[model samples]
Target: MTQKKDTILSREIGKLGGFGARLVAGLLPKNIFELTIETHSPPETALEKAFTILSTEGKVIEDRRIDPNKPAVCAIVGSGLGNLNPALVEVYVVSTKENITKLVIIGTAKEGLIKQYAGEKAARRIADLLTQVLP
Candidate 1:
């Protein structure tokens, strides 16, 4: 996955989407990351690949489409120490340009006060791992 510090995306995410910045808002402590990958892959193909990659490193609890008509999937995976760290990942596939598909990934996880450091790190790790598998 390509890493970027996209100011435009940051702005749009804060002002747009039905989420209305709720997903991007900071409350207490939150670990969140987003990735946009362009490929010529199908939505289900990318979703399956992400699930397989995450499963190798963690236990995937949920893998389902957010809506029947939308090319989006939401999955939750747990890893590390009896699955103490769990990550919620949302992937949206969009057709960009002529034939390229752009996969938008949003991942989030909570930071527990008891093990504050571990929680955030593990959560981001899950996001990083999942990003590598996006088609």
Candidate 2:
């Protein structure tokens, strides 16, 4: 009987710990950030440049056109300090006007108590790279 009671108590404690962890995660802020810039290159050219630039930073997980008449979107998983600090990046290339392309980069990372700014940092780095290379 004592053994059964101990097992039950341990299970309940495990459940409570899981609940607390989930509660804390729900209360934490989402680690998402975005940066936008305009370049003189056309939409297709800008997107190609973005892919080339971001591929150097990390693996380009996806590259596709959402719609025939809409902007193109690219997804990248940026390499960070290690495997635990990967940043997810989404890049959208839009044609705002003739010969003007707007690139929007959104980056997000797993929310943690110590590294909340990882996503913003990654996004800024990617934007800077694009700005320097895109023309």
The model with the greatest lDDT is 2
- The digit string of per-residue lDDT tens for model 2 on 1-135 reads 112322322233334356565455444455678888999987777778777877787766666644555555444444345533456667787556876878888876555667647678778888888888877
State the TM-score for model 2: 0.68
All-Cα superposition RMSD per candidate: 10.8, 11.8
Where in model 1 is the C-alpha error above 4 Å? 1-28, 59-62, 65-68, 79-83, 113-135
Local accuracy of candidate 1 as per-residue lDDT tens digits, 5-120: 23222332344333544354333254566766766656667666766765665445445643455555554545335654454555566555566667666665544355434334
Candidate 1, overall lDDT?
0.52
Which lDDT values do the candidates have, in the order given? 0.52, 0.63
**In model 1, which residue pairs have backbone atoms overlapping below 3 Å?**
none
Clashes of each: 0, 0
**Candidate 2 Cα outliers beyond 4 Å, as residue runs:** 1-29, 65-69, 79-84
Per-residue lDDT, model 2, residue 32, is 77
TM-score of each: 0.50, 0.68
